[model samples]
Target chain A: MVLHIMADALFISVAILTIGSAIVALETRELVYGAIGLAISMMGIAGFFLLLDSPFVAMFQITVYVGAVAVLVIFTVMLVRTQALFSIKEDPRRKTAGIVLLLVFIGGIGAVVLASGLGNPAFTKFNKPAIDVATIGKQMVTYYAPVLVLLGLTLAASVIGALALARREDIEQKNERVD
Target chain B: MATVPEEFRFGNFLASIIWVILIVIVLLTLVILPLTFIVLFYVPLPPVNGEVLTPYLFLTMIVDPTRTLPIVKYLIHTTPFKVIVFPGFVFAAIIAAATIFVERKFLAKMQLRVGPLYAGVWGVGEGILQLAADGLKVISKEILIPSGADKPIFWAAPIAFVATAAAVVALIPVAPGWVVSNTDVGLIAVFAILGFFPLIALLFSWASNSKYPFIGGLRALHQMIAFEIPFILSALSVVILAGSLNLTHIATSQHPFWFILFLPISAFVFFISSLAELERVPFDLPEAESEIVAGWLTETSGMIYGLIQLGSYLKVYALAALFVILFLGGWSGPQIFPHQLGPPDAIPLVKVLTLQGLYNAVTVNAIFWFLVKTIVIIMLMLLPRGISPRIRIDILLHTGWYKLIVLAFVNMFVALALIYAGVLGPGGSLSIH
Candidate 1:
């Protein structure tokens, strides 16, 4: 009983943190603060993953999001110093469009929920088996093997493309110098 | 001390303090006291000795001589004790600080100079106090900020770096069942925490809002990301051999033969990648002083610089410990601890030293071998700091991306070969278990 209550408390607190930080990310004035807020929000989601007992996915999320994506965002924001980004003038057209889009998203979700009737108050006890990485690996190879190969190939192709593009830039610069 | 001008009389200040105290007293009595009582009523108290204990009972237990055994056992097994003392921040910090002093002395020997002189210990010139002295110097120095620097990030990044390093330390098992969080995926969690270092470096450099910092940050990003593949790949070879991601399992799997004998290439790859990851010499291009004025860390000074360097050394210790855990048998050695320190029944609570005492004996033995291996690895890590100059960026990237990755792959194949040949596996012909 104590464990259940503690888990519930932890879950609620983590959910609040995720929403609060995400709101801060959107509403903050400073770009760097926004980026920090985003990182915090991502971490809160990782905490949620931990609560869900998917530690591997949680670690992967942290490694990719808080470690790489946030840094990439910071780098881009630092490098690109465009004056237009400093002063975001509100347009009536854009404001109306945003509100309409938000309403549509909300209405669609509400409609789907009402149609499906997912509000039955039945609770099922969670008794998950202890699943380890080997199980996940075996399933990935047997069931999703083609999808795994597809991802690998796509990543390899993109890497080759990026390298070629970089090489081309170097050659073009050299050609310009010679001319 | 600077005197405050007596624009207003001291009597007025004294009267204001009295009013504040009066308000606080009223607030505590009217609001806070009832709230505390309500909370105490709602919360369930844990039972002890067939009695629901209160604060009064706890106080008496503190003075009780016979209660020491249970108290000692609880303290030893507690999370805070493990995290703060053994195999955690304080332990890692002491090792890191010692590394700094010993590294200075070692490099000094290599260069024929007096290193960390005058900061001697009792009857020894080991620079035992040098790290503390340097810490004081850094703390006392002024912190300077660039004009357009992102102040919040500039301050937070170094702290985050240290926290992440400490998080990695928390996962390392110094002995069996002796970790802060004994998660099954401890090894992967270490890699995940380690991934934060590059982000911290980049963020701090970007936060500096200076040209040199920007260049340095980019180099750090490239350097860290490039080496990560080889790092994971090399670790993959070990995972294949052990068939487990738990650091403890990996260690125990190596009882029959250390993984290095069968997977030397992976160990080499792991070592090189770790050196790169730790940003040690010959791979310290991100912070090369000659070309980039200490690279991404150019703008850091005072305590900020101190924190980053401390974090770096902690990482050094962590990686060295990991190397020991993976390639060398972690905490495994011939049992050298005496069967009993004295007559087991001498102690009242422990007739024959008790379960706790026996566990402690084993733990001490494990810690001894673990430290021996870790220190040797640390010395090896520090060797290149004196021997080699930092390499160029192109060569560093090429080696990280191409050579190390290929070597790691080759070892992965070798691991697969061993497993299939039934030479060593979970229940193979020559299984370690």
Candidate 2:
């Protein structure tokens, strides 16, 4: 019982950290600060995944989210023309609407949670053990093979679209010069 | 006689003494943590019987049967026993200082010049003492927080980096079960802790608010992506062959046929990726010391920077051990002495110590091999640092996305085909299972 309580405490602590930092990330005026907060939140999420007994997911979270995405976000933020990003402002009404929508969505989720039974340990007790590399690979190749292909295709399409966008921008610039 | 550090001068003499004592306490914590295992685990076990007892000890007795390794293994397991000896940090500090001096001495000799003969005995001890002197010097030096630097992040980054290194030592299975936390997910934990390194490094770079660190961090992020895919994929191959991600299981799987032979490509990929992970030569482009003054370390100074250096070495040691456990059959060597020397049931303690000893000895023996592997790779890293010119950033990005990514994808397919073709298998079944 004590162990369960401690686990629950740690899980809640991680969730709070993740959500708190994520809010700071989304709401922060400073773009660099947002990236930093996002990285911190991602780290918290990774720790939460560890509690969930999914080390593979935790590693993926660290590698992709914290390591890659955060870095890229910072990189883009650095590249932007404005150095003092904190001084910038967005439309207040749009921000208020976003907050309202978020609260309503969360309220709906809360309502659903209250309506359902959740304290069931049996739901988590599967005979199958933790997912290792082989099982994941086997599943990825055999059952979810099409999804992998789709992801690859999506990546390719995005790259092609980006190239096309750049080409069109170059053409427009040339036309402007000609005019 | 000497003035105390400003941070140390909280109030008066007593407070200064307390501050000094606290630093010593922290140093002791770093050194003595490794030794607790030997005292707690190996000493109290019952003696071994005449029957060679366990398979692990049996194997140790078989491999290198010359020395009574099963008996005297504790002495060599001192890598982890680093905690017990208060002077361990001193030795580390000394060794690091000596490394610089020794390299200089070798260089001077090449140029037909004598090294620092006046400092100590043939300048041998000079390098050893230089580290302490340098420590004293660096500590006294003014710490510069650059104009545009993000103050808190700049200060916290080195601490975070060093903390991750400290955390790794807790999980590294030094000899047998002589580990702080022998979790089932030991291998994954190793990488998880390692993953913190780049984040802190990038943080340090960004916090400095410098152009170089920004570029370094950007390059490091890209390099990490390039190498991490292959690293994890190759690690997955080992997991597939071993049937477990547990370090113990991975080690034990090397019994009949080592995983290296079965999945040579995986081993190659893993080693190269590890080299890249540590941001060492060939892949040490983030620092490319010539191009950028130590990359992310450009602004760092004093003992904090030394801690980062120490952390890097710790990472090196951990990665080497992980490589050994995963590929080079861990602690499963032969016992030197027979149980007839001291009857079966009377010596369970002896047997345990001997096995532990053999485990340590084999690991120590393999440390030489491990060092050889690491050194060769380090030399390879240093070669590019010295010899090769830097590739353009665009070229680096292109190679990562166009070549390495495709190669990793192909390697995954290769791994799958190899698994299907029973390359990582023994006869019919998957070997580890």
Candidate 3:
């Protein structure tokens, strides 16, 4: 009984943290603070994954979202001049559009979730044995090989594309110097 | 040079001490005792020897010699004991402290100097107490924050660094069944925890709001992130061989032959990547004292610097232990520990004192070998600091991305070949039961 209460308390606190940090990420004036807020929100999501007993997913979530994505975001934000980071003017129309989009997203997600029967106690109780990492690896290779390959290709293409763009700028500057 | 206040009185000082003691006593009795009682009432007490131990019984058990052993054994197995005392913070901290002292002495010897000569009695102890003295000095010194700094992040970063390092420590297994957290995804979790260090470094440097720190922080980020790929890939070879991500399992899997012999290239990649990740000499651009004035750590002073050092050393221990577990045959040395400390018919007091109930010869041997291997790895890690010069940032990045990754992949293919050729892995001809 005590354990159950503790788990429930932990879940509620994590949920609150996730929502609060996400709100801060969207609403904060300073871009740096927003990045930090986004990182915190990602951590809270990892906490959710932990509570759901999928620690593998939790660790990957932390590795990808907080470690790579958020770091990149913060690095980019820092690259911009400090004066420009905090000097954004608030636009009413943009704010309204953001709120409407947020509501639509929430409604759409809620509708899909309700329709999918994911809220059923039987589905939520985790009666099935937890899938081990080896099984996941095997499935990734055998069943989801195409999807994995495509994802890798997409990432590689993006990286090459970025390099090409950067190289083009360098060449353009060099050409201008020659001219 | 310094003088006491004219109005300062010995009697007043003694009275103040007494008053403080009185306040502590009053608070303990009034606030702490009640709070403890309230918490105890709510907490479901575990059964001891087939009976639920109440608060009164627990107090009695503390003094009663006959019941004490069971209670002590039970406490030893508890999660809090594992996390805080034996296999967790205290153990890791002790190793980290020893590493610092050893590194100082080792580096000094390499550089032909007597290190820390004045900290111990008549220098007979060879400055064994230097770490203690340094800790005292660091604690006593006031923490200074630069003006216009981000106060919250500046304050929190060092602490977060230590906490994340400790989290990594918690995942490592020193001996069989001796770990704070024995999760199935321990290796991945370790990588996940490590990913936070670069972020913390960048945040701290940014928080300092200084030019040197900014440059250092960016270097740290680039170096750490760049090396992370090779680090992960190298460990992936070990994971493939072991067929399990559990650190303890990985350690135990190398009973026949160590992974280093099979995948020396991966081991090399792992070692180099770890050095980069650790920001040690040759890759210490993040805190290059000569060029960048201590890099990201330029603004850190007193306990802040102390905490960061502690965290980094803790990381050093963790990474060394990981290397031991992955490449070196972790805790797989010859049986040197005896079956029991004394004869079977020894005195009860002797048996109790020697912890016969808790003693396991295999565990002792495992822990002994693990520490020896870990220490050797740590010494190897420290060796480069004495001999090598820091590399340029571009060179470091190039090594991490181009050279190490290819090397790691080479060993990965080697591992795959070994697996397919019936040399390693499950049911392999070479795998001994």
- Best-fitting candidate, measured by DockQ? 3
lDDT of each residue in B1-433, candidate 2, tens digit only = 7676656644677887899999989877876754654444555542343333344554465564433553344443455455432113333333334444554555566567775555455646644455456567777877777898989888888777766776665665544555556566777777767766766777788888888877788678777766766767767767766667777767777676666666666667677677677776567788888888778888877766776777776565566566767766755555443434333455546655445335434445443444444444433333433444566657755655565555545556665676688766445355544
TM-score-best of 1 and 2: 1
In model 2 chain B, which range of ten residues has the least summed lDDT? B84-93
> Measured with DockQ on alpha carbons, how good is candidate 3?
0.75
What is the descending TM-score order? 3, 1, 2
Grade the docking of candidate 3: medium
Residues B254-313, model 3: lDDT tens digits = 998999999999999999999999999989999999999999999999999999999999
| Model 1 ranges with Cα > 4 A deviation | A27-30, A86-88, A110-123, A163-179, B1-67, B121-123, B347-359
Per-model interface RMSD values are 1.3, 2.7, 0.6
lDDT of each: 0.87, 0.66, 0.93
Q: List model 1 lDDT by residue over A1-179, tens digit each.
A: 99999999999999999999998998787777788789889999999999988888898889899878987886676667646685867789998999899999999999998777566544345487667878888989999999999999999999999988777677789999999
**Which regions in candidate 3 have their CA more than 4 angstroms from the true location?**
A1-3, A82-108, A119-121, A169-179, B1-44, B49-51, B54-61, B64-67
Distance from true location, Cα of B365 in model 2, Å: 6.7
Least well predicted 10-residue stretch by lDDT in candidate 1 chain B: B350-359
Which lDDT tens digits does candidate 1 get at residues B1-433? 7488758788989999999999999999999988866655666755554556565555566676445445556666777899998878999999998898899999999999878877767859666688889999999999999999989889999999899899999988889888788787888898989888888888888889888887988998999999999999999999999989899989988987899999999999999999999888989888888898989899999999999989999999999999999999899987788666666557555543444343467778999899999999999999999999899899999999899999999999999999999888877777745
Interface RMSD (Cα, Å) for model 3: 0.6
- Overlapping backbone residue pairs in candidate 1 total 1
Complex DockQ per candidate = 0.56, 0.36, 0.75
- Residue A114: error of model 2 in Å? 1.7
Candidate 2 residue spans exceeding 4 A from truth: A83-103, A119-137, A146-149, A163-179, B1-126, B166-172, B179-195, B233-236, B262-274, B282-284, B330-418, B426-433
